[model samples]
Target: MLLFNTAAADVFYKQPKTCPHCQSEHYSLTNHSKILRFTILPVIPLSISYQRQCDDCGYMTPVSWYALPTLEMLSIIKYFAGVLLLGYFLIQTVLGVHQQTTNEVSYINKPKLFDTYFVHADKFTDTPKRINNLKVAQLVEFDNDNMTFRVGNYTYKYNKDIEIAMRTSMLVQDNYFSSKTMTFRKEQIQQFYEDNSIYKIMRPELYSLFGGFVMHPPKPKPLYTGVKLDKHNQEGITYFKDGLYTEALNSFTLSAEGGYSWGQLNLGQMYRDGQGTQKSLEKAAYWLNKATQQGNLKAKIELAELCLSYDCSNLNTD
Candidate 1:
């Protein structure tokens, strides 16, 4: 039993020179109305009763059957249409800005493969062992598939394995090749033997796996002392491999505080395995979930394994 009401007032008609009753020049005709509704629904027709008032005499008289002008109705329609058009444009502008921001974020996260170089051999071989050292040549191309390069006025097509290895080694050197970030599509680590520069810097022992080719040792670079999250995570991995769990935990914690996904994954693993502190499934799940939210595939796999092997009834599945 709810009651609702609305009221409005507007000029119904303009008086011609003077009021009829008072014989005054100042006069006007105005209409006032009220509408009743029940339960928020209109239950009465809209009606306007006009009144003629003489400004000089202070006299009022009732009038009837006043219709709204066609021009006034058109103006109201145009005003509403203008408001709708403005709202539509505003919505499009907001959506465009949101899409642009999304594109910018994706561009920053994806690795750019521009202006990169690779090494390939002309003689086709199943393994790096059969590749002739003299046939080794420098190549540069943009397309990931069908690598075409010219070396000494001779064009050659490089094997897919060789291309994959070169790209993987490049990303590794750039510190972006990892499970927590971007990883190589193929598991052809054996092809790394093709790159002499990478072998000399990373795996010198693998040199014997390929043809013996003399390569100049890389010059020593200045050690970095700045606080970098990736460096901290790498240091933590080194300590963990050496069984210094306390030092590894501290490094991982520092790296995780800086929002490194790899560091968060390692810290979560340490908590689950009870390496540097008491084993706590809750803490492990918390850190692992954080890493998973950042697109860490390794963290997702680890969290799934933890849930399957332990009590995770209270864990958030979402």
Candidate 2:
């Protein structure tokens, strides 16, 4: 339950004043103050009235407006300092977010090195686990068609309560374990922005305050077209060619979970053939269908063959 009440108090301060009743210069200034309160806490000021009292005779009279010094008025203004500070803080926060958003858009279009993007990890892959969903991708290189990012190995759970300090940690050097990088098409990056998958972008220049270059000089790492997902898919193919079906299946599973259509197709075949696991037509159809949706023609053929025995009517073959 909420309890509200107004309480008044007379704040007395020593001030030079001539009391009308006593004709004495020794007087105290007092304000008849009332405040709106919630429970035991004062919420706001309601009203205030000023008067002067002679200390020697205990006589009270109205305050004289002409006698109040400029410094005294400034003292009264200090009472509203809390309210003023609160207003300024709120305005600054709104402007800061707006300016940062503008900077992100500008940075994204220009494609600078070391520009960091805070993104949803699940969106980066097709079958992502929820245990760790918040991730960051730092820009490494870009071309007309595609842009590459060094993805962080470490991930955190996303929530509204997560603070900026936690998010900023994603950009720290050690997070990009094993120098893993992922490349995305320019069109896909645009789609990510449209879907709000990328929430914040921080530029390399922001790290100068911490002496980023002087602390750790940038070393040129060789760029490779084979990202993690593609590498997994290729590894599966090599294992399959070498008659190592179990290893092929394991690699394919990793690749498929990371959103590789070819990996999905190969993994479906392994399930159907019972190479590494039991032959389950249902599982085959499920994975094959996923690949087919991503425009993999080989998966369509395999899925159609699997449907010859299983119920194609229940699957999304079209």
Candidate 3:
């Protein structure tokens, strides 16, 4: 419940008079006090009340409907209006400053992928020492369709396998860790692209151009089980490739539980293929849909295939 009241002591009306207590000729009779109240219970009065007083003698008397001088009333009105306007402007200024400070701190705290790293294509070699010795160059452009990029005046091309790896790395960097979380905002993505060296560091192939620089990819923090989710996902992929479906399923399950999209997609595929698990279209669709929500194109394609082949009319393929 909200309750409030306002009280004002102002000279509503004044007149020259002789003080009864002080017996002074310089006495002034004035109507002063006023109060207004609002309460949840309707017991409080809403009207303003006033009282008259002798300014010199401090003698109080009852007042009934005293008339205020026009000039004095205008002066009181101007004073209150000025105070309210100043308070409003002060509040607005404080809020604006607070919002600006918050934005500045947020920008300062955002994760940065690299610090002063540069690209080098001409120094392509097989030795780590040579790669370290190579001078850094500035990157120009990247061609997603051709899987090629330009650093300085040199252009480098990568194979389809490398392209897939690069894209996977980008996706993992974007989704696997909170520090490197990606936003869908075009302005933010553009800012990241322009301000960071992530594009050059994303692919080992790009690092190969710098004489196999061999910068290790960033990994997620280990969980309570002392295993990183990405490691489990990678292990699952390796097991799957080696035809170890049962082991792959275990690893993928752990990874999927940890919210790894790669593992989710793989687990969905295993469920669909009946590899180390009973084939269940419902389970496949569920896991695939989970992965697809995280921008997993492969999972989306698999989901589309499942929808097409099984005539899953209830599924939202789009």
Candidate 4:
């Protein structure tokens, strides 16, 4: 049977009383995206997600679940592969050969499908929504015009609810202590507490189910991180574009450290070519390797080429 948990229970709530962190009701929807399974045997969803931004206290919460309830996630495909491998091994044992009769048994491969792409509907137009098995209402937030979330490897969209929640959460988180409407609403908060399901996550091992819940700060998506990186990277690009090679080198260095591999590769190329800086094949190789680890394919090829043309005594291929 499929038995895996996203720890969503610890992340979201069933009947939330108040803002878990600030104990306020001011919240808005921020963004959302969905995970798709690319299997041809059946069209299924891997996960459904709702990214909620608290309206009252500027907190973000993630709500998600297995899209396919019936399929045992771990056993769905891998289990069958293991079975095939075992069958092949058994047949080989009887034949007294370590190899297969026709071809070696290998991992069953599947074709990539376009439907495997995550389908996203964000809060930019309306509050995109879906109720969980517990009937908990979830909202999808998205940017109205961009239509893409642009998070780390994943993207989320904007929605009205998400915007509202974000606005509310920002206000609450930043100015709750100074809000003119600081009067507490105990009754409404209590009911919300009853509905929230993620309350238990605060103390998974320490607290009992009946104990009170603890609140956590919202985690910003990589998109936000990417924005910071972009700002720095853009500064470097501006410098480089204007032929301010030295300034460009410094700016690009900061951007690369901030997780922009594109910046890293650019800096390496500069070192290799002696454009703005002195010719240093070693630096080029080091930075290129770093960029490649971040999935910069061009960096990989460039590094390889550097090894063949120059004496890479300082560079370690490993």
Q: Against the true structure, whose TM-score is highest? A: 2
Better of 1 and 4 by TM-score: 4
lDDT of 4 by residue, 1-318 (tens): 223212111122323335678877754333243222223122232443445566667787764434222332232343244356557889879675433212111100111111011122232112344441111111112222211111112122433332343334321233212112111133322233344321111111121112321112356565554423477778989998898989998988887777788888988898999877899987888888888887779889988898898776776555
Please tell me which predicted candidate would have the highest lDDT against the true structure: 2
Q: Tell me which residue pairs clash in candidate 1.
A: none
| Full-model lDDT for every candidate | 0.54, 0.73, 0.54, 0.46
**Candidate 1 stretches greater than 4 Å from native:** 1-229, 313-318
lDDT of 1 by residue, 1-318 (tens): 646455353453454347777788876665554444444444443564666677788777776543444543333332234346667899999998777546433322332322122223222222243233222222223233333222222222444443344434422233222122112221121233243311211112222112321122355685986544598899999999999999999999988878999899999999999999899888898888878888889999999999887776776657
- Tens digits of per-residue lDDT, candidate 2, 36-68, equal 666555556676566777789988876553455
**Model 3 compared with the native: what TM-score?**
0.28
List candidate 3 stretches off by more than 4 Å.
Answer: 1-229, 311-318
Per-residue lDDT of 206 in model 1: 27
Task: Give residue 59's error in model 2 in angstroms.
Answer: 2.4
Regions of candidate 4 where Cα sits further than 4 Å from its true position: 1-228, 257-259
lDDT of 2 at 38: 65
Clashing residue pairs for model 2: none
> How far off is residue 215 in model 2, in Å?
11
lDDT of 3 at 148: 20
